[model samples]
Target: MRPLQIGILNVMHDKAATNARFTKVLTHAGRPVALHFYYPKTHYPSGAPAEVAAILAPLDLAAAERMDGFVITGAPIEQLAFADVTYIAEVQALMAALAGRAVPQLYLCWGGMAALDYFYGIEKHLLPHKLFGVYRERRLAPAPLLAGLPDEFYAAHARYAEMDRGQIEADARLHLEATTASGELLLVDRPEANQTFMFAHLEYGREGLLHEYQREVTAHPERQYLRPAHYFTDPQTMSGPQFRWEETQHVFFDRWVDRVWAKREAKEVSA
Candidate 1:
C-alpha cells in the first residue's frame, strides 16, 4: 500500500512541538504516513523563533489538494473576528479548493470554528473567561471517525471563543457528535463534505496544558488565569499532568486515517 499523505497547517507558535505531536498520532495508525507541514503565507509568524520558522513551508493549495488528508491546527487568535484575522482569505481559498474533493479535512479548535462560520454561517461567541482545561465529553451520536472511542472521553480545551451549539444542532448538513454536560460543542461531523471539526485539543502532549498555563502566567502575571482543571495530578503543587488522554487521542486519529483510506478506496473503485 502506498503511504498516506497527510498535510498539516500548523498555526501554533510552538511549531516543532505541534508537528511532533501530530506526527506521533498519525503514524500510530499502523501505516506508512507522509506528513507535510505548512504555515500561512498571508500571515506568517514574524515573531516565531528562527528554528520554528525554519520547518514551515508556505501554504500551497495545489500541494494540499494532492494530499490524502489535510488538517488545520488551532491558533491562539480565537478572540479575533473571523474577518479580522489576517489569514482568513488564504484559509478560505484553501477550503474552497478542497470543497467537494474526496480528501478528508480535520479542523481543530479555532480552525473548526472558522470552518463552521465559513461553510454553514454558524457564528462563534466569546465566553466570559477562557475555557482552559481538560473537559469530559459524552458521545452524542455514532460516527465512523469516532469509532472505538468510549461513550465518555476527555480532551483538552484552551480557547476564549465557542461555537453556537444551537446553530449546529439545527443545521441539517451538520451532525453534532459529542458535547459536555453543559452542552459545549466538542465534535461536529460534516460527512457530506468529508470534514470533521473538533473544538478540543486531543493532540496535546503530556505537558501541553502545563506549558500553556506557565506561559499565560508569565505573559500576564497580574491577571488571574484559570489553571487547567482535571489536568495536573496535584493542583496545589501544579505537578503531573497525568497524561490521561493519549490513548483516546490515538484511537480518534487511527479511525480518521481509516476514514481517509476508505474514502480513497471508494473513489478509486468508482473511477
Candidate 2:
C-alpha cells in the first residue's frame, strides 16, 4: 500500500519543535506516513530562524487537497477575534476549499476553535483565567476516534479561550464526544464532514506544559500565572510532569489515522 499522505499546517513560532512533535504522534499510526509541513505565507513569522523555516513549504491548496489527512496545529492567538487574525482570510479559504472534499482533517486547540467558528456559528469565549493543566475528560459519546480510550482519559490544556458548550449541545450537526468534569469541551466530531476538533494538546511531550509555564513566567514577570494543575509530581517544587496520558494519546492518533484510511478506501470503492 502507498504511504498515507498527511499535511500539517503549523502556525506556531517554534516551527521545528511543532513539526517534530506531530511527526512523532502520527508516525505511530501502525502504517507508514509521508508527512508534509506547511506555513501560511501571509502570516509566517518574520524572524523565524532560517533553519526552522527551511522545513516548511508555503501553504498550497492544491497540495492540501491530495492529502489523506490534514492537521491544523494550534496557535497562541486565541485572545484576538477570528477576523482580527492576520491570516484569517487565507485560512478560511483553505478550510472552505477542503469542506467539499473527503480529506479527514484534525484541528487542535486554537485551530479547533477556529474550525468551530468557521464551520458552525459557535464562537469561543475568553475564560476568567487561563485553563492550564492536564485535565481528565469523560467520553460523552461514541466515536471512531475515541476507540480504545478509557472511560476517563487525561489530556493537557493550556489556553484562555473555550468553545461554547451550550451551542455545541444544541447543534445537531455537531457531536459532543468528550468533556471535562467542569464541562469544558475536549473532543467534538463533525462526522458528516469527517472533521475532528480537539481542544487540548494530546501531542504535547512529557515536559510540554512545564516548559510552557516557565517560558510564560520568564517572558512576563509582571503577569501572574498558575502552574499547570495535575501535571507536576510536586507543583511546589515543579518536578516530574508525569506523562499519564501517553498511552491514550497514542491510541487516539492510531484510531484517527485508521479513520482517515478507511474513508479513503470507502471513497475508492465508490469511485
lDDT of 2 by residue, 130-153 (tens): 999998888888866878877777
Question: In model 2, which runs have C-alpha deviations exceeding 4 angstroms?
Answer: 45-49
- Per-residue CA lDDT of model 1 for 145-185, tens digit only, reads 66777776777888999999888889988999887666787
Instruction: Tell me which residue pairs clash in candidate 1.
Output: none
Give lDDT for model 1. 0.86
Model 1's number of clashes is 0
What's model 1's lDDT at 41? 82
lDDT of 2 at 156: 86
Judging by TM-score against the true structure, name the best candidate. Answer: 2
Give candidate 1 misplaced runs (Cα > 4 Å).
Answer: 45-53
